[model samples]
Target: MKSSGSSFYDRIYRLVGMIPPGRVATYGQIARLAGRCSPRNVGYAMSSVPPDSPVPWHRVINSRGRISVRSDGEPCDAQRQMLRSEGIEFGPGGTVDLSVFGWRGPAGEVSNDEQW
Candidate 1:
């Protein structure tokens, strides 16, 4: 049987992969879409992603729209650079305006009442 952790991570990867280039999603947003998982869990899965994985792990940020600081002292400069290369402009305060660049998940996946 597949481990629940692996299955959960797979689901997170699939969801993250759907975030189109130039758009971003918050960890909380993904957690809501991926029911039964917490935002922290999503972060954990993201941190565990393989260096060569195609999952757009750089597109996810905190609810405040900032790249989360890595606890390992690994700078988030690379993540910021990747997002910038994708045409995602960050504000002076370093937060992406969700209203302008957030992906609302797959069509019909989110409704007015469920908007993040």
Candidate 2:
């Protein structure tokens, strides 16, 4: 039987996949939308994503609009670079201004022609 954890992660992945390239969603936002999970669960799901997955993992950040440090202690430069390539700018304080770049939700899904 399929584990419920897998199902929850799938829901989280689908939601994260919908986050466009330049915009970002907070872990809290994803959890709230995904339901039956917490921000920490969202973080866990992100960490478990395979390198080959299509989910845009870099587009999820903390509520403070900053990248959460990996448990493995790796630098977040890669995430920063990816976001930069997608036109996301960071302030001098090293946090994206949530007001400007925060994704509203999947309700405003990008058009089919728009490359995520």
Top TM-score model? 2
Find the 10 residues in a row with the least total lDDT in model 1: 107-116
Those runs of model 1 whose alpha carbons end farther than 4 Å from true positions after fitting are 1-5, 73-75, 108-116
Provide TM-scores for the models. 0.81, 0.85
The sequence of per-residue lDDT tens digits that candidate 2 reaches over residues 12-52 is 98889988879999999999999865888999999999988
- C-alpha local distance difference test of each model: 0.83, 0.87
Across residues 2-107, which tens digit of lDDT does each residue of candidate 1 receive? 4536677777887888788899999988888788558999999898999887898989998888888888765589888999999999999788988888887766
Candidate 2 residue spans exceeding 4 A from truth: 1-5, 110-116
Local error of candidate 1 at residue 68 (angstroms): 0.8
* Top candidate when judged by lDDT against the true structure: 2
Q: By summed lDDT, which 10 consecutive residues of candidate 2 come out lowest?
A: 107-116
How far residue 11's Cα lies from its native spot in candidate 2, in Å, is 0.5
lDDT of 2 at 13: 88
Residue-level error in angstroms, candidate 2, position 54? 0.8
